[model samples]
Target: MKQAVVGYKVQNLLNFLVENPQLKDEVIGISEPLAATQTEFVMRRRRSLQDEDAITVYLLGMEGTVAPLPLVSQVLQWQAENIKAFVHSHFPGDADLCGIIGRASQCLPPLRKALNATQVDKDEVLSLFIDHIDALESAKVPYPSYYSELLEMVLEDGFTSEVLHSKLFQDAAISIKEWGSPRQQQTFVAICSICPTATARMLLRYCSYDDLSPYVFDYFDQRSVGSMIEPHTYLTIRRRLEKSLSRISSEINVVFITDSSNGAVAANASGAADATFFSVRPFNKPVTLDTLFVLDAATISSFHQLRGGGVSYPLLCAEARECNSRRAASNEKRKTLPQGAVV
Candidate 1:
C-alpha cells in the first residue's frame, strides 16, 4: 500500500507539472524549490487543487516543489522517453527550457542510452551533451575522460567556426586548460589547428592572456612549424601572439621569439642590464619567421643600440646575431642540397 501511494504521488506530481505550464516554468527557473511555491502561478494552482485528495493537497504544498535538476531526474526516472517529448510538447519553441531540461536530465545514463537507441538527431544530441556537461561535476563523472570523449564525439562529423565560438566549446576549452591533462591539451591543439583563422579570431575575442599563451605554444607544438609556414597563416598567428603579449602585465618584460631550430621561446626579462633568458617552448622543431623576435621594454632599448651599430648590450646583441647567423647557415645549407633532398 505504501509503495502504491508513493508511486501515485510521483505520477500526480508529474501530471501537475505537465498540466500547469507557467507553474512548471517557474519551478524550473527557481533556484530553490520552496521559493517556487510562493510564486503566483503555483499559489493559484494550489487553490484550484485544494480539495482533490491528501496526495494532491500535499503536492500543492511544499511537497510538490522540486528543484529543476531533481525534478527532471524524477521525471526521467518515471518515463525516460517522455523528457524529450515533454520538452517538445510543453515547452514548444523555448530554448531556455530546452537547455534546462537538457542540463537536468544529462546525468541519467539510461535516458541518454534510450535517446541513442531511438536514433535521436545528432544536433539534438550535441545540444544535450553541451547542456549536461556541467551535470558531470555534480554527478562525480570522470570529468577529463568525459570531456575529451564528448569533444571527439561532437567533432566526429567536423565542426564549423560557429561551433567553435559557441559557449559550450569555449567553456569546455577553459575547463580543459584548468584540468591541465597533457592528452587533452593535445586535443585542444588539434581542434584549434583545423581552422586556424577561426581559432585566431576566437582567441582574440574570448581568450585571455593565460588561455592564449598556452594555446599558442601548444598549437605550434602539435602542428609544428610546417603548418604555419604559409605567409597568411604565419601573419595571423604572429599578430595574435603580439596582441596577447602586449596585454601582459607591464612589470614582467617577456621576449617572444622563434629560435633557429623552429622552437617558440618566451624569455622573461629581469632588471639586470642584459635580460635573463628562459626557454618556454611548446615543441622542438625548425620554427622560422621573417620578423623572428619581439623584444619587450628591457631588451628593446639595447636592441635600438644594436640597430645603430653600437653594442651597448653585448649579451642580447650577441644572441641576436647568433640566431641570425644560424638561420642564414641553415638556408645556405638547403640551397647547396640537391633538388628534392631532405635537409
Candidate 2:
C-alpha cells in the first residue's frame, strides 16, 4: 500500500550503488540481463495483447520519437483507463504512442528489480474489507434491493466503493444509514482499500505471476502482481549484485532483499554470507535461495553525469595540480637535455 510494492527501499541502495564507477559496470551486468529479459517479455506481451501487424503498423508510423520515459511515467500513474487517458493527453496520432510504447518496451527494466522484491499488504487489507462488508450485512434489515445490489455489483464488476456513492445506493443508504456499525463512507472506504491489490491483479493477469505468486502470495494473488524473473537472468543478476558489492571497497553497505507476499525477510546488519551485507528475505520462510528471484524491474533510470554545482576539494585539487605541474616540468627538462647527458 505504501509502495512496498515497488521496493522503494531497495531502490535507494541501487541508486547509490550505480554512482560508483568501479561498481557501475557490474551493476549494469547484474541488472542488464534482467532488463533485456523484461524487454523481450514486454514485446511478447504486447504482441499477445494486440498483434504483430498492428505493431508493425505503429512502427512504420513513427519517424523520430523522443524518449519514452517521460510518456511512460505519465502512463504508469493513471489509476484506471491508463492508455485511454494517456492517448488523449499526450498523443495526436498513433505515432507518439507507438514510439512511446516502443521506448517503454525497452526501458521498463531498470526499476523492475525493486518491483520484483515488492511486498504488499493486499491480503491483509482484503481480510479487513471482508470483515467490514460482513458487519454491514449482519446489521442490515432484510431489503430486497440492498444486499442484492451490493453483492451483484461487488461480484460482477469487482469491489469498489463507487457503488455506495452511485445512484444504486439511494435506496440502501436511506434504509441503512441509521444502522451505523460503520457509516456508509467508512464502510465504503474499507471496500475501496482493496483497490491497489485489485489494480495489481488486473495488471499482471496474463503472464508469469503463476509461478511467482506462491513465493509472494500476499503481495500477489490470482489477479497478478510481479512475475518471476527469468531463471538464468535472475541467477546471473544475483551474481552480479554480489560481484558489485564485493568490488566496491567503500564505506557503502548494500543489503540485498527479496520479499514474498507472506514472506518475512530476516536481516539486520548481516553480510554477504559474512559480515558486510544484510541478506533480506521478504517472505515468512527461509527459502531465500529456493524461491524465485524477488528483484522486480521497472523503467530504467539513466546514469547521470556529475551535477554543475558540485564543489571540488580545493586543497586536494591544488595538491594534485602542483604534482602534475612538477611532473610536466621534469618531463620537459628531460626532453630538452641531450640523451645520456648528466647535468
Candidate 3:
C-alpha cells in the first residue's frame, strides 16, 4: 500500500539522520524523535538545527515524500501548545485552561468576524476550550521537539518585527542583564548574531561590562603618551575589551579614568584630528597611547560632564566635555573630534 511505503521511507530517513553523526551536524535538521538516544537534541539546551536550506532541498528530492500521520499529529499538538501559551500570556485570567481550548478561543475572533458578529465575548471561547480540551488531550499525538522554533522566532530582527516576532512571540522575551548572569553571555552573542548593530550600540552600552570605554580611550590615545597609564590597570582594561566596537556605529562616547603608577595625565591631540571611531572599520588603525589616560584627569572630566559630576553609568552617556586644560601647554594645535561625531 502507498501508506506502508511512505511510512517505511519516513522511518528510514529518521534512521539515517539519527545514525550519521556528521550528517546530523552539517545537514539533517530534526532530532527531536531521537531524543531518547541523544541528549544533545534536548529542547531546553540545543539552539537550532543547521543547514536549513540543505534540509529543505533534501526533503524535496524524495519522490512524493509524505509525512507520517503521527508526525502530522505532532505538528498539530505543537501548534496547539503555541496557541495556548500565546493566549494565556496575553488574554489574562485564562491561563489555567487546557491547550485545545486555547486554540479554539484564538480562532473565535476571526470566526466571529466572518460570521458578522460585532463583538464576541472571550468567556464563551474559554468555556468552549475547556469542554473540548479533555477530548483533544486524549486523542492527539504531541510533538517531542524542543522550543527552538519559538526561541528563534523571538531573536530575529531584535524581536522588533511588527508582523512576526512581535505579534506571535510577543509573550516570549529575551533579557541579558549583565556580564555575570548565567547564560547571559550566550544570549548576548545570540543577540549579536541577529542584531549586531543594536547589540554593540545599545545593548552593550547598557550592560555592566562593555567595550565602549576602551574603544574611546584607544581612539584618543593616538595623541598622548603611553607612560601615563599604569601597566596592570591598562592590561585589565585591554583584556576586558575585544576591539568589537569597530563593527558597530554608535554616537555615544566613553571617557575612562584609571589610577596610574604615578599621578594623572592628559592627551596631546594633533591637528587634522586624524580619525573617528564609527562609520569605517578601524582595521589596521594605529593603536594609541591614549590608553595611558585610563584614570587620568581628562577622562574624569568627561565622566563628570556626563553625570553632572555625580555617580552614574559613566560609559552610557552620549557626550561629555574633555578637560583639555592639561593640553593647553601644547602649542601644536590639534582638532579633537567627538568620537562618532562625524559619522
Candidate 4:
C-alpha cells in the first residue's frame, strides 16, 4: 500500500521517504487532526521522548497582542519542553519583520536570560522564526485586523509626554512667525486667540507704529484717544505716515495759488476801489482772458449780460471778492511768520 501524507499534504513526503531509504518499507499514514495540531503535539512528543533531534514548531497566524517571544515561552512551558525552535507566521505584507522581532525580543529578556543564551542562541532563534515567517508570507497568509489596530495604538501612544508638548509648542510658534508682518501678526494672534507676548514677538516685527494705531484706535475707539496714546504711539504713526507720503510724492511736485487778478486794483480818491472783478464759474474755472474779468461798474454790467442765465453774477462777484480778501490776509500772515515754523 502507498504511504498516505495527511490533509492532501505536500508530495515532498515521498522524497523524504526515498532520502531515508531505511524508512521505505514503513507505512506512512497521516491524520488531518494530527497535522492541524502538529506544532503542539510534536513539542509534547519530543519532550516525552527526550529526543536528541531538534524539533521545529510553527505557530501559523496565532492571535493575541502580547509580544511573541514571551507567549511562545509560555506555550513551551505548558508542553514541558525546552523548545529547540519556535516560529510565528507572517502575512505577505509583513515587510519589517526584523524590526518587529527586535522589539518583541525586548519583552523577552527574562526568557533569554533564563535560557542562559549566548549571541549564537539569540541568532539561531531569530533565524528560525524569520524563516518560518518567510515561508508563511510566501504561502500568502493573511494578517489579523486586530494586529493592525494594536500596532496603530502602540505608535500613537509611543511619544513621551514631555516630547509631545515640546513638539506642539515648537510647531505652533513656527507657524505663527512664518505668517508675516505686524498687521498679519495681530490678525493671526486675534484668530489664534493668543495674547501678545515676547515668545510671539515675530508676530510684531513687521508691524509699524501706525499699523498698530488704527487697530489700537478701533480697539479703544469707544474709549478716549488720549487714553490710548503712548510715547511710541504718536511718533510711530507720524513717522510712518511721513515716510509713506514722501515715498508717494517723490516723483511729483504740487503748488497752490489764489486768483491775484481780482484781488489787486488801483485805489480810488476815497481810498475805496470799485468792487474788484473776479470770474465767477467753478472754483477751478480755467483762467482765460475770455472768462470775463470785471473791475469797476462797467465790467460788472458786461459780466451780467454775458451770464444771461445761471447763478447770480452780483452774488458770485461778492463771494469771489470775499475769497480774494481772505487769501490776501492769509498770505500777509504767512509772510510775518518765521520760515520753517509750524503753523
How do all models score by TM-score? 0.18, 0.19, 0.17, 0.14
Model 4, position 158, has a per-residue lDDT of: 21
For 80-143, candidate 2 gives per-residue lDDT tens digits of 2222333333332445333433343243443223223356333342333334334533552332
lDDT of 2: 0.25
> How are the candidates ranked when ordered by TM-score, highest leading?
2, 1, 3, 4
The C-alpha RMSD in Å for every predicted model, in order, reads 32.7, 29.3, 29.6, 50.6
Each prediction's whole-model lDDT (CA): 0.29, 0.25, 0.24, 0.25
Q: Residue-wise lDDT of candidate 3 within 188-296, one digit each (tens)? A: 1111111112212222232223322122112212112132223343332233233433333222122122222131222112111111111000011111233322311
Clashing pairs in 4: 277-294
TM-score (C-alpha, index-matched) for candidate 4: 0.14
Which ten contiguous residues of candidate 2 have the minimum total lDDT?
A: 55-64
- The candidate scoring highest on lDDT is 1
**TM-score: the better of candidates 1 and 4:** 1
Candidate 3: worst-modelled 10 consecutive residues by lDDT? 55-64
- What does candidate 4's lDDT look like per residue over 1-343, in tens digits? 0111120121233224323435533423432222233223223322332322321111001101001122222222222111111122232134454345444445456433523454435456555444543443344233333322323222222212211111111112232333223443211111100111111121122121112212211111101111111323223322333343453332211100012223212211122221222211212222333222232211111122212312222333333333334445544654686864322
Which lDDT tens digits does candidate 1 get at residues 185-286? 211221222222222323323332234334323232113222322334343443444453344322211122222112211212211111221111111111
